[model samples]
Target: MLIKVNDRVEIIAGEYRSRPAKGADKVVQGKVLKVIPSTGKVVVEGVNKMYKHVKPSQRNPQGGRLIREAPIQMSNVMYVCNACGQRSRLGVKQLDSGVKVRFCKKCNADQGEIAPARKPAS
Candidate 1:
């Protein structure tokens, strides 16, 4: 719930665990990647993946195939600590600017800032 971008989260509530993630994955142990507050979904590096098929165009001319992606729910994962190399629950600390930062409960390291979201212009 307190996770941030670049926070290495662990699959505390998913089928994947104790293994290196596969698919378009990164943040194997760091960064939150993305957050979907409305749906409570969060994208972790190399976590969830789905395959897709595409029709071949002039580029392929063979009715080729393609794959797509989607983010998983944040509630399914927990932050991991750099010090202990283990998934840790988060602790909240309010800064002087009234900003809340995520701290690792196991090692007390800051999970860093959440990056600004990119959006398409209307």
Candidate 2:
């Protein structure tokens, strides 16, 4: 997953693309909340919103519509490089110390490393 958690991304496609509203930039930027590589989807902050009708519960006395972010296809987003501040492609590079890291293809700057998954405990 090149676009991991906390990485800033720009919505390039889908319904969330830039639209005239009030005073807003033409390009929408947000951080990645979750990445579902299995489904090729990503939950970006403040994008692809959906409303969930909630029932009354102990936590809430009144039930109402809950707005939340919905997952968008990974192909619909592009990685925004923190280094160059531009939307760019991601690429892998290996260091002489035998460490592999993700880098911005446009600026050729190091982004970060993907941590290995932890093993399940017995």
Candidate 3:
């Protein structure tokens, strides 16, 4: 998956996309908290919130409804470009220096380096 943890993303589809209770802007965009490449899902911060009902336990003296983010399909989100402030697809490119980096497809802006330049094999 191209999307990485800490990357800002905007939900393009799914129930969370239209949740107004979180405010218009907040409902769409969030930082990626976890990436589940094996399952092709991602857990975004403040998105896909699910309430878990629990009984009081030693760990939690007063256990009740707890809100937590659930995993959403990765296809529902698009990477938010820091340079253009727009949601766009990402592409990987290797620079002349041999460093691999991600770029925004919309504005062609470099997001950041993914891998450092490596020395040529002797």
Candidate 4:
């Protein structure tokens, strides 16, 4: 996946589309809270909110319904270009330092340095 934590994303599909009021033009832009590559999903901040019923516990003496962000399909989101300020596809380009970086396909502006690939556990 091209998205990482802290990356701004806009929901392009699903029921949560056009749900965020903080963004412009019904485009729900938010930071990526988590990325689940195993499930091909990403949890965006303030998107795909779900309510969970919980029992009273030590952690929550008055446990009731709690709203939380849920994972959404990776295909439903498009990366927001920092330069163009629009939802766009991401393109990978290698830097002179041998680091791979993500850039906006529309304006070809660098989004940010890509995180190093995760090493598989032994």
Candidates 2 and 3, the one with greater lDDT: 3
TM-score of 2: 0.82
Q: How does model 3 score by TM-score?
A: 0.82
Worst window of 10 by summed lDDT in candidate 4: 18-27
Q: What's the lDDT for all of these models?
A: 0.64, 0.83, 0.89, 0.83
Q: Compute the lDDT for candidate 2.
A: 0.83
Candidate 2 lDDT over 43-94, as tens digits, reads 9887876677899888976989887777989999999999999999999877
Please, what are the lDDT tens digits per residue for candidate 1 over residues 72-100? Answer: 76777776776777787877777665566
With candidate 3 superimposed using the best TM-score fit, by how many Å does residue 54's alpha carbon deviate from the native?
Answer: 4.5
- For every candidate, C-alpha RMSD to the true structure in Å: 7.1, 4.5, 2.9, 4.9
User: Best candidate per lDDT, number?
Assistant: 3
Listed in order, each prediction's TM-score against the native is 0.60, 0.82, 0.82, 0.80
- Report lDDT (Cα) of residue 90, candidate 1: 73
